[model samples]
Structures are given as C-alpha cells and as structure tokens.
Target chain A: MNRLFVFCEGPDDIRFFEGVLKSELREGYASVELIAYAGMKHIRVDGFIRGIGAMGDDYLMVADIDSDRTVKAKKNRLKRWYRELDTDKVIIVIKEIEGWYLAGLNDHASRSLGLRPLPGTDRITKERFNRMIPDHYVSRIDLMIEIIKRYSIKVAREKNRSFRFFYWKCLE
Target chain B: MRIKQVSCRNFKSFSDLTVDLDEYNILIGTNAAGKTNFIRIFRFFRDIARHGLGNAISLQGGAEYIRNIRISSDVPTEIGIIFENELGVFSGVRDTRGGSHTLSFHQIEYRFSLQIEEGGYRILEDFLRISCSCTPDLGEGESGQGELRITHTEDGVFYELSTPEGIAIEITEIIPPYLQKNVPRSGTLLIENPLLVPMPGFQRFFAEIAIYDFDPRTPRKAIPLSGRSDLEEDGSNLAIVLKGILADPEKKRRLSNLMTELLPFVQDIDVRKFMDSSIYFTVTERYGDEHPLPSSVISDGTVNVINLICALYFDEKPFIVIEEPEKNVHPYLIARVVSMFGDAARNKQILITTHNPGVVRHADIEDILLISRDSAGYSIITKPARREEVRTFLKNEVGIEELYIQNLLGL
Candidate 1:
C-alpha cells in the first residue's frame, strides 16, 4: 500500500479527506496522513513538496482556489511558484474547499436542515451555515461532519465536475 | 584548507544535503532553516579534535540531538568530507599514551567519514592517497601513487595496506606500521597511526579548521589574566589578544589603518593594563578636543568590528567558520568587515552564516548558499543552478539580497 502524506489547506479540507476519502480509495491510500496548513497562503507549494519526494512515499498537496479565477489558473500560478516539482502531485479544489460539501448537499442529513442544495456548484462559504440550517443542533462544522457522514459520492460527482475530477485524480 | 565538498546524512537539520564550498562561502537563510546547524558540522569535528568522541557527543546534548529527528535511530548518523589534500603544509604533534610522535606527508585526497554507532560513535571509513605530483625527479618510489584505507566493519578497523590487513596488528618496518589496537571513538587519529604516516598532513588540516560564535557580552569583559593560546570561544582574553597585536608594530599599524578606513572617526586605539591588572582598549576620536573613549563607553559597532579584525587578521586557520559578523556593526562598517572577510579568503577558506542584507549584496551568487527548510524542517541548501530561469534572474540584475527577501531562491 502506498503511504499518502496529504497536506490540506485547512481543517475543512482535512475533514473532507478524513470523512470522504478515508473510504473512497481505501487500497490506494491505506495509510493516508493529513497535515493541516493555515490556508493556501501559508502553503509553500514548492519546498514543502520537494523535500518529501525522496522519502519514497507518495505526497499530495491540496489547496483551495480562491484568489485565482479558476482551478486551471491557480495550477498555472503554482507551476510558476514551484517551477520544477518531482514525484509530488498538486490538486487544487475549485472555488474553495467548502464547494466540496456542496457536492453532498442532496443527502438526507443535509436535507433535514430544509436548506436547498447550493446551485451551479458554487462554493458554500462558512457564512452559509448561519444563513441556512434553521434549528441547527450543533456547531457549523459538526453539521458539516453529519452532512459528510450521509454524503452521496454519486450525487456529489454529478453536481460538481471539479469534484469528480479531483476524486478521480487521487484514485488514479 | 579547501573543502571541495561535504556530504551529510542524518546530521542535525540536514537529512541529506551536500554543499560545495568556495574559498569565501557565504550562507544566507531565513530563520530556523538550520544554517547554524550546517556550520555545526565543522564545529562538531573541531570539538572531536579538541576533546574526544564521547565528550563532543555529550556536549551536543547526546547523539539524538545531533541526529536529525526525521531519521530513525537504526540508521547511523553519517558525516563525511572530501577535499583537495594540501598535505605538505601540515604541522601536527600526535600524542599517544606511549609517547608523542611527529610525521610528515604529501597526500593527494582524503575521504574521512564518521558514523554514530548504537553505543557512541566510531570512525567507520577513511581513504587517503599520495599525491601523483611525486615524480622520478624526486624519487623512483614517488613516481607512482600509494593508497591508504582504514575501514571499520563488523570485525574490526582494517588497515588495508598493512600485512595483517587490520589496525589491531602491527606491520613490518618496510611499511608504516599500526601502533594501537583501539578503535577511535571521536575521530580518526590518522596522524598518530603509523598506517597513515604518509597522510598525516591531511588530518592536520582537519584539526586546524576553526568555528566561532563570538559572544559580545561576558567573554568580551575583563577577566583575570590567563594565557590565551588563541581566541577563546566566548571572546575572553580579547584585551590580551589586542595587547599582543599591539606588541607587533606592523600588525598594529595595519589594524589602525584598517580601522581608519573602516571607522574614519577613530583616530587611534590604545591597549592599556590597569591598576586592577586587567587589560582594556580606548579609542581616540579624530574630531577636535574630544576625550578618548574607553572600550566600556565605546559603541558596540566599534568593539565588535575591532574584535573581528584582530581575530581574522592573525588567525592562520585555513578554514574559519564565523556566524553573523554583521551583528551591531555600523552599516558602513559592516561593508568594511565584509570586504576584509573577502580579502582574507585569498589565503584561507572562510564560511560565514549571515542574515545581513549588506553581506548578501556583497556575495557572488555562486558563493552564496541559500538555505531553506522543508515543511518537516530539514535544511535544503540551494546553489546557483544553470537553469534558464536562474540565468534570467542572474542577468536581470536582481541582487541576491532582494532575491532572498522575495524568497525566490528556490531550494
């Protein structure tokens, strides 16, 4: 089994991988470990990856695309930042990590909040927790945990193309 | 004197980083990039040469502290150096329990390595060869090359050139013989071993390497008079060192001229012994009628610059390791010290760890070792590469000072 050193942009990205990827690609990333970074700003896309490659372990860096107009644009910018990266893969989540949760909005746990699914696969910012989710029982992130527990990988892929792309890239 | 290159594995902050050094190697790194740890390699060897293997390891907070945390204990902490062997100039006195012995050599290249064993440390590898410059004109025996190798394995330390093929046994007088059976725990006692009599000069060069962390506080203070063999680690006996320099009129004149160029305001410097029998320095200002200021009242820049000039000017160590000479020196004075370090490298090797922008600006890109750490905090030293982007950066007039500030010297 390949050991995965997953560098996440924030806690939510960590949760998404722990809650979702922990089951999706069991054999590929049997020993997936997550390191939480402050944000994309705090992620050193190059040195962080360069140093780990020679360890003979698979490495992945996941950061949200917020400042750049598109994921491709963000990847381009990172390419310039890194110039040359060996044996490490960089995968950018579209809009933000929260957009990943929008993929699972059709689940029964999410529907219990009586909130509609986020349309056009746009990012569901943290503010969306307070605006929606009436009669919320726990914290915003706790609710997100529940949402992920009941998340439908099939519906998520149908709702978000970038999410589907990212998922397949990891499995590959 | 010259270190062609050095490689380290599981040594301090460097998990695996090989650095090629120039005559004047200047290293600049961000905080916690382990630049100090990089220089510690030489200090580690120097400590071993001064004390022994056991004391040096303990002084560094034990073997675990010296080894990188990322590396497993099962893997030995390996450190090695490969340098151009300037063997003829070595002057080392080897002391043994039996007696002291002197040896001379003309070595071509020396590869010395040490590994931290489970219990302590051992000299695991050594390879030395005689210079090919030896020709028939000198002697028929000198025409070809001679090899000396000492290796430690599960059995014992093997003197490859010896008859018994081990350091534990002695050899005939036809060849340089082995004198001891014990394994060297701290460092290779190559000079003392008859097996390596022809390569003692290489080991002496290693013994002569100096690493300094000059403290501006207490060591610089007046203490009871004690004989100073060389500059103390803490800059103690600085006044005595200054007094010794003053004893030589030409050296004193050169220092005064350098200071005059560096600090134009300084008219003259006086080293005096007081009623308390302690020595101190006083600087006279060039400006009119102002009373000479004692070292106690002088600026930090004056004291630090003077100490550095005196220390570097006289010390004959082929390799001198200094940390942050830019500390407290005036901006203009920092440049002067930088120039002095550069000029001194003509005769010897100098490795300086610096964060000062002026020092960075003064360094040639090839001479600058840009150090950065991985997320796991292992040091990665970057040298100027032949990549097109680097070429563009070099041609675009972007000084290393600015490039480092921008964090663009990617490692």
Candidate 2:
C-alpha cells in the first residue's frame, strides 16, 4: 500500500490541515497514515522505513517563509537544492505568510487563507486592503500553490494531477 | 580487530594513563571523570587517522592550536594506540603538545619532533630510524633545512632521498610494498605538531575500521515512513533515497517484514507527491484503512528506533556506535531492543555508550565499558573483576538508578 506522509513545522499546521483537508484526501489515501512532526529534526520517518517498511514515493515538507531573508535566502537555497534532488519523491512548500499579511490584505488574507498568526492573536482579523494592485495580485498563497504544482511536475514527473498543496487551506 | 592497549596523557580529564584492553574490557569512572573522554580517544584516533589530521582537529572542537598538554606539568601529553594490523604490529602516537610519530612493521619508525618558536611551532628535528626488534639505531649527522629525508629499507639495503633536491643517498633500503606510496610534496611545509600532521599510511589502515555514532540528529524528516537509506545532513535528498528503494518490489517487501517486527501497527507505507509537488509519508494500519503519519505525529523514540534500524539494516556493512539508546523508550522495551541489536550486530563490531543500567544488564558484561576517574586525575578504564562486586551490588539494597546516582560504578 502506498502511503502519503506530511511533515508540518508546528502543531497549528497539523491541526488546520488534518481538520480541513480530511475530506479531500480521505478516499485517495485510504491506506495512508497522516502524521505531523513538530520540528525538522525530531522525526526519522525515512530511516524507519528503510529497515522493515518502505517509505512511499510521496512526501511533503511544509515550512513558513516569513521575513525577507527567509523568502529570498531560503527559496534561493531550495532552488539550488533542486539540482541534487531526485525530484521524483518529494515536495517542499515554503509559505510566505508574513509576506501576504503585511501587504495590506492582513485580515481578509488570514480569514480567507486560514493562517494562524504566531502566538498573540485573539481572533481572525477583519482588516481589509484599501488599495488593490497588480503587485498585490501576484505572490498570493493561491498562486504560490499553483507555481509549486507546476514546479513539482517538472521534477517528480508524476502523471497524476491529483496532488494538492499541503498548505492549500490558506487559499480557502 | 581488538584494541590491544591505550595510553593517554593530558587529554581532557586524564593527566596521564595507560590501560590494556582484554577480550572483555570494562571502563569504570565517576561522573565528570573523563570516562567518556577515554572512550572518545578511540573515536579521536579513528577519526583523525581515517579522515586526516585536519578533520580530526576540526572534529575535536577546532581551536587553531590544540596545545593539549598536562595542565600543571611541563611534560607534553601523548596518546598511543597499539593494535595488531594484518602485516604485523603498529602503534600510532599523538603528542598533544609534542610531535606525531608512527611505529610501523618493517622495523622502521618515523618521529617528527615539535619546537615552539616565535612564528609558530616548527619541526625542529625529524628522524627516520630503524628498529629491528633486536636492535635500535638513531642515524648520525643528519642536518638539513626545510627538507624531509625519507629512507626506504629492504633486505638490509637502505635508499635515502631528500625532498626538493631528490638527491638519493645510499644508506640501506628495505622498501616494503607500503612504502612505495611515500611521495613527498615540497611546496607546502608540513606542520611539526601531531595535530596538524597527516598520516597517509595510518589512514589507509583506518578505513577498514567503521564507526557509526547513530546520532539522533540524523534529521528524522529524512526517514520516509517507507524508504531505503537516509538523506544527507539536511534530509533534502530523502525523496531520492526513497525512490531508489521503492523502485524494487523485493526490497519493499523486506522493508514491510522489518516494519512488522518493529512497529506492529504499521501495516504499510504509502508515499506520494501531491499535484503541488510536496511529498508526504502515509502509513497503513493492519486494518484495511490507512492514514498519513505526519512527520509530527510520530514520537521521538519511534524516530530514533527507525533511524537505528535503517542504518543497521540498509547499509552494506556497518560498525555502529550508539549513545543513550534508552532515551524516550519504554523501560520494558529496552531488553527487546538490545536483543535486536545484539542479533543484528552478530557479524559487526558494536560500540555503545550509555548510562542506562537496563541496557548494561541486558547485554553480556564482556561488552560493557566500565569507565571511571581516579584521584590522580587519570581516567582508569578497567573491567569489573569476575568477583561478586558488580553482581552483588546489582542484587543489593540499591537499585540501578540509585547505584548510578550514588556513584557506585562511577560513571
């Protein structure tokens, strides 16, 4: 049986994805086990599979790409990283949540995308963007998901188009 | 195959010490007592000799100059690991504050001495002497500036040559097969101190020795719930390693069988990339249903176990080193896990460091390393006598936890 594994950086990512995306993955991943890892180093799921069980070709790693340094440097590092990758078994998602939040569409972005801000948030914000522009239209989470899907196809070469961005809940 | 002897000086907590290793060795020491440092010497020698001087020094916490000598004494510290090699006997020595020397088989010994000068420590004197077990000879009138004289000897004939000039002198040459590769590089001057010197010959020998630390830091995310080997440091290549294993059906079934033994609840693993290009590991249960065991849902213990099993079972041939194997694991499972390692380590040499008595009690005492510190500031690594001391202590009023806490076996 082929299993799909998901590793989220934090607990909130786990709860939000499992709670919201359950319906979409339910049938497609009938024999799949979904788990959320809190940190990068805490899990050795690949090593576990090597000895007794096998790891499926499908894997997803999610992390927040907050701040300018994270957005530019991390993505660049990940871009160069693709050269060494097999490109057929894994997908990496870098969320520019902070980029979306600071662009004047803070509350609507949060509510529409289901993104939970770091610790001190009381509730989803109702703030709205006063000015709409082409700059704002580009680089949204929805567009990011689409780009990731296309990028994955170039690398993984999987024929199935059923794959969805692990952080797709942000687009809801 | 076995460690014949270990001599240490001014290394960490040990000021000076020499200990022999028997078939069954025990190293007993108190907490903060340099026992770990004693075990670390093997790693130090293995790493330095295997990886080269640069890597060894870097791995041992690089500090530019490793002036590791006796704290209060003027005596330069030295450590020599004497072991039996296939050709014959060899002793690799490192003087933390002195020089690097090697005693090889063909009755030839190379010694490079260090002199602390204003610029930096320089090689004041170097010698390539011969010692044919029955006799020793220190060559006479050998004076040269910035040149390493290598003498290859064979059948009582010595052929000596200088580095840059390549001037050959007729001393006597018994050039064994190993000495053929002794080519000197002239442009860069090799450092005098052992810390900066490279041992090409020792490295050749050390490659046969394998050491696996099984560090929990081997990025857990790299382990696909269903995969073969692990990824590189950042676990970025996990996808590649997984795909390599999944391409074959026989190997996948082998993985399934092993998983059944370790994680009974794990029926199977399903891996896939969503249309978005993100990869995920989904686990199937014994029941028909399955779900993804998000990298987060798994516990640390499960991750560590999986890492160990993967490295042990997946690699071609391996030598394993484990630290605190009992961490995050249930006490009841310690015996079972140890037994599994014991069985797996049947053909491999295994070195483990642990504070868990459960781990110790479960294994044969012969494999236990009883490390402890003595009053002289030297770490004394000795096995517990066959006497009833350790056994009686285990059966006595104190439990394993208290025994360690009360400083019974030191550390």
List DockQ for all candidates.
0.01, 0.01
Tell me the TM-score that candidate 1 gets on chain A alone: 0.80
Candidate 2, residue B4: Cα displacement in angstroms equals: 4.7
Q: Which residues of candidate 2, in runs, are more than 4 Å off?
A: A1-172, B1-5, B18-31, B49-51, B63-73, B82-218, B222-258, B269-283, B316-318, B385-388, B391-402
With a 3 Å backbone cut-off (N, CA, C), the pairs that clash in candidate 1 are: B53-B186
Tens digits of per-residue lDDT for model 2, A9-120: 4333443344334454455554434444321122243443342234443444454544425434654554353332222333333332222222222333433434332222
Model 2 share of native interface contacts: 0.00
Report the Cα lDDT for residue B303, model 2.
54
Candidate 1 lDDT over B1-411, as tens digits, reads 477777788888888878778888888888888887888887776666666555767878786687876677666676666666445532222222222222223334444455566656665555454432322222222223334455544454555432111112122321333433544434544433334343444455666787776777654465555567477655656777777777887567567655654666888887776776677777889883667776777777677777677657667677888888778876544544665776567567888889888777655566788888877778988775534666577566555566677777773
**C-alpha RMSD of candidate 2:** 24.2
lDDT of 2 at A39: 19
Q: Which has the greatest TM-score?
A: 1
> Tens digit of lDDT per residue, candidate 2, span B1-411?
444556765556666667655433323335676655766666655664456544654676652233344364333435555443332332322223222223333322333333322333332333343222111112222322221234322212123432112223222222344444444332111221221222334333334443444434443343334443543322333444445556677456545544544565677665566554555544556664565565445556655555555544444433344555556666655655555565455334455667676665455555555666576555556555343666676554344334555666543
Segments of candidate 1 deviating more than 4 angstroms: A1-172, B89-132, B138-144, B152-157, B161-175, B178-203, B288-290, B385-387
Docking class of 2: incorrect
The alpha-carbon RMSD values of the candidates against the true structure, listed in the order shown, are 25.8, 24.2
Error of 2 at B183 (Å): 5.0
